[model samples]
Target: MFVKITNAGGYQYVRLVENYRENGKVKQRVLFNFGRLDLLKNDPAFRNIVKKLSDIVERTTTDNTEAVTIESEEDVSDAVLKNWGYIVFRKLWEELEIDKFLKERATRGRKIKFDADKVSFLMTIQRLIEPMSKLRTYHEKNRYFGFEEDIDLNQLYRCLDFLDSIKEDLETYLYQRNRDLFKMVVDIVFYDVTTIYFESCRADGLRNFGFSKDNKINEVQVVLGLLVDKEGRPIGYELFSGNTIDSKTMVKILRKLKEKFSIDNIVIVADKGLNSRLNLKIIREAGYDYIVASRLKNASKEVLEEVFEQEGYKRLDEKSYLNAEEIYGDEFKYKVLERTNVIKDEEGKEFKIEENLIITYSSKRARKDKEDRERLVSKAKELLENKGSITALEKKGARRYLKKKSKTEEYELDEEAIKKDEKFDGYYAIQTSKKDMDVEEVLGAYHDLWKIEQSFRVMKSCLEIRPIYHFTESRIKGHFVICFLAFLLQRTLEYILRKKGKEISSERIMEAIDSMNFIEIEIKGKKYLIKQRTEGGAIDILNVMKIKGPKNFMTYEEGLGFIGINK
Candidate 1:
C-alpha cells in the first residue's frame, strides 16, 4: 500500500493504493482516497490518518521485499509524550454512578456552549484529583487526557451557578444512590461540624467573624455540618453561618434529617461541644436517641463521688479497664451510673429524664494533665516572682493556681485548686439516652465518632475545603457542595477497600491514584497509551478496587474506554 499523489488543474489529490503483481505485471488498486493533499496536509486529523496509512504501506513493502532488520533509535518515529493519572479516579467515578447521575440531573440546553453534565463531571473529577481553580483546570486541560478540551472558564463559572441551583436535588439523588448501592442504614447517624474560613476580610450574611476552627479569627468563615453513616460514608450536610454555635446547628440538622430524609429513630453521636441541655432535649423531643460526650469536671459532686466509689469495673484490655480499682500506665477505666436530671419542656413544665452516664478515666490522660498543670503553674510562679501585673494572667485564668493573700498583696500557690484539678484528670463522661445499652456498647459507639472527625480532616487537609476563594454566597455553597461530593466519593472508595479487607487510607489511595499514569506515544498518526506500572500502595488499591492494572499498550480510544469514556 502507498500514497499516490497527483496534480491536475491546479489541484493536488492524494490516494492510498495497494500494489500487487497480477499476471507478471505490477498493478495498483485504490484503497482509500484522501482528497486535496494540500488541504489534507493542513488538517491535523487528516494528516495523522495519512501518516498512519503510509506507515502501514512502508511496513508491508519492507516485510514482503527485504529481510527484516531491527530499526535503530533514529529510524523509529515514535516519541513518548504526555502522561495522565486521573483514569483510575475516573473509573471509580463511573463505578459510583456519578457520571450517569449528573447526566440525568444536570440540565443541558442547546444554546449552551458546553455540556453542563460534562463540565460538572470534570469539575468533580478535578476536585478529587487535582482541586485547582476553574481557570487552571481549563489551562491545564491537556494534562488530564484532554477531558476538558471543550470547557472554557466562562462555561465553568456558569456550570457552578447551575450546580448551585440544583445542589439540593443533586444531594438527594446522591444519597439515594449511595444508600441503594451500599445498603447503608440510617439507624445510627454520626453528626459533626467544622469551620471553613474564607480568605476575604469582607463578611457576608453567611460568612461572619465568629469562632474559627482554623484559627483565622480575623477572616470570615462558615460552619459546615456533615452527617455520615456508621461506616463513615457521608449521608448529608448543612451549611450555616460561621457565627452559628455548634449546639444551635443541631436543631436544623435534626429537622432536615426528619423532614427531608425521613430519617428518625437515629442515635446521634457527637463530641462534648454539641452536648447541651437544650440540644439533648431537642434530640429527645425529636424521638431520637443520643450518645454525646460530657465534661467530667462539670458532674455534680454526688455523681463524682459515686463514680469514684463504684466497683465491679470490667477490664476492657491489658491497658484498659471498666470499673477496675487499680490504675496502670495508660489504663482506661469506666463506671456506668444513672443520672436523673430535671428539665423544662417547651410549655415550661418540669420533668425528669433518666440518663446513663459513662465516666471514663485514663492513666495516660492523668500524666498529660499533670504535665500541663505543672507548666501552667510554672508560668504562674514566674508571674508571681517577677511581681508582674497579675491582671493579665488573672483574666486569662492561667493564674488559677495563684492565690492572693487575704490581708496582704502577696500571692501564693493555690494548692487546693491544683488538688481539685488533679482529681478530675484522665476522667471524662459520656451520656446516652439508650438506657438499655451496656457501658461497653455506648463507649464503643461513641468511639466511632472519630470516623466523622476523620471525615472532617479529609475535607480540610486532603480536599482543602478551607481558605475558600469564592466570595459570593451561592458560589461558596457550591464550592462546599463540590467538596462534599468529593468527600462522599472518597469515603465510599475507602469503604469499599475496607470491605475487601484492604486496610488502606484515603490519603494513601489518593497518592496511588495520582501516581498511576499512562505514557502516550504517537507514531504514524496512531496514538498509543502504555500504562505505566504503579508503585507503592497503588497495586493493592487497584486490586481491591477492582480496577484493571496497567496493560503493556493500547490505542488512545481503547484507553478512553478503560475509563468509561468513548470518543
Candidate 2:
C-alpha cells in the first residue's frame, strides 16, 4: 500500500492512499486529518511532515522529560534547645541574660562545675519521666546512642545527680530573672496552686500532702504555686504542702511576691475559690487592687434583693470589642452588662441563671456595677418557677422525719433538705476591673485562663508529666521543674506559631523533632554520607519555621556547618 499527502485546510489534513480488492476489482483510498483521514503511517506522510520541526523536537526532549533525583543529605546534628522556634523565649533569655545571671547567683555560694547550661543531668530526670519502654525501644532500634563513646547508659543516671544539685539554684535564678526583667508592674500577677504526686517517700519542708490536683487521693503530693504574667511567662512561684488551702496559701505566696518584687501597684486576679471576705480585706488592706470572681449565690438575702431590684447598671451581652485602653489600666470605666444562661434538663425543664458583668472603670465602675447588680437578682428571679429561698434556713436534724417505701430502704427528709440546699450551685458572676473594657476584652481574659487548663493537658499527654514515680520530695519537685521547662519550651514554640498565624501544636513540634532521622551511607570513596529524613509534617513545619534544608547528602564538613559546630 502507498500513501500520498493532500491538502492543508488552513488547518491541515493528511490523506491516506490505500489499495485493496473490492468486489473482485482493484480500489484505492485516501484519508485526511479532517476525519478518518487523520491516520498517518501509522503513515510516513506525518513523520516526513514533522521532520522539519527541529526546534520543537529539541524543546520537547528537553522540557517533557529529564532525569532528576531528590536526595537528602544529613550530617551530625544535636537537638540544641535554642532555635528559630523559641524567638520570644530566646529574647526573654537574652533580656534576663540567664547564663550570666545564673553565674552571678551561683557566686553567692560555692563554685559549681556545671550550672545552668550544663543541663544534661537535669535532662536525665526528664527521661525517667518518659513512658518506660518507649525511649528504650527507640534507642534499641536506632542504635545511635552507642555510636559515641561517652554516651553510655550510666551517663544518664550521672546526669540526673548533676541535675539534682542545681535544680534549686535554677529555680531561684528563674525567680530573680522574673523580678529583674519580666514581671508586669502594672497588672496583678494571677497566682494559683496545684499539686503533683510522686511514688517516693522522701519528705521535705514544702512537699507535704494536701489536696492533689492529680486526683491521687491516697498518694502524698507536693503543692505547686505558679504566678504568671499576663503574657504567660512564669514570673514567680512557690512550693507548699499538699494540704494547704488554695486561698490561704495564695495570700502567703502573694505576700512573699509583695516583699520580693516590692511593686505595690498590683491588682490580684483570682477565682471565687480565692475570694474569701478575709482574703479580700487582706489584699485591700495591703493596698492592692482586686478583681475576684464573686460567689453571687453566697451574698446576703437583702444584698441579693437589692441587686435584683436596682435598675441603673448596663449589662452587656455580646463578644468584646474594646480597644487597648480598656485592658491595661484602672482609668477605664467598667461597662456593666448582664449575662444570662438557659439551663435545660433532659426532660425539657429549663432554668435561667442571670448574672452581672461588673467591669471596673478606674473607680467609678464598681458603683455602677453595684447599682446594676441590685437589679440583676430581681430579673433573674422572674425566670425562677419558685423563688423559694435559694438559701437554706435551718439545720437538718431539728425536726424533719423520713419514711421509706420498703423497710430495707430508709431515707430521711432532713438529708433531702441538706441536698436541696446544695442544688443552686455553680459560678454566677463574671466581673472585670476595667469598666471601659469591651465585653469581649473582659471575656477574653477569662478565656486566657483556659491556657492553664491546656497546660495541664500537655503535662499529662505530650510531656508524660504524671504518674508519680519518685516518692522523695526533692525528686518530685525536680521532676516537675524539668516538666515546667519542657512546658516552657513547648509553649514557646506554640507562641511563635500563634504569632505567625501558623496552626500547629506542641505535640506535633516535639514529634517532628523526635522523628528526625539521620543515617550513614557508604560509597567506594573516602567520603562519608549522612542521610537525614523526616516526617512530611516535619519538613512543612521547618519550612514554616524558615529552616533551610540541605540540598544533598551532607558530608561531615557540611553537616557541622549546618549546626554551627566544629571539631
Q: Judged by lDDT, which candidate is best?
A: 1
Relative to the true structure, candidate 1 reaches a TM of: 0.79
The CA lDDT at 484 in model 1 is: 79
lDDT of 2 by residue, 1-567 (tens): 243455556433443344657799987643112123444335332343233222222343466442121121121121111111222233334454655654564456744444433243225223322333223522432232111223434433333444456665665566665555533243646656667666644555655556667767666666666766555555556667767777776666667657765666665667776766566556655666555576665655654554444355443332232343344323332335555434454567655434345533222344454454434434333423333432342322222223232564322333453343333222145544444545555555654665555655666677776566655455555556656665654555565566677667766766555544333322222222233344435666555556665433444455446543210
What digit string (tens of lDDT, one per residue) describes model 1 on residues 1-567?
A: 567887878998876666677799987665455567776677444545556545544564576642222222222233333335566556666766777766665544424456776777667767777777777867766656546366678887877777787787777777777778778788889999989988888987899988887888689899989999999988889999989999889988898888878877889999988988888888888999999998777778898787677484545754234333343344776777777867786789876668988877778777888889889888878888777668544624458888888898788888898888888777778899989887767877887899999899988888877788887788888777778778887888888888888888877877777666655554434566655555468877777756665455567887777655411
Instruction: After superposing candidate 1 on the true structure, give the runs of residues whose Cα lies further than 4 Å from its correct spot.
Output: 1-85, 108-113, 146-148, 310-330, 345-347, 382-413, 523-526, 565-567
Give the lowest summed-lDDT range of ten residues in model 2: 75-84
Query: Model 2 TM-score?
Result: 0.57
Report the Cα lDDT for candidate 2.
Answer: 0.48
**Model 2 ranges off by over 4 Å:** 1-111, 114-116, 120-188, 200-208, 306-409, 412-427, 430-442, 520-547, 565-567
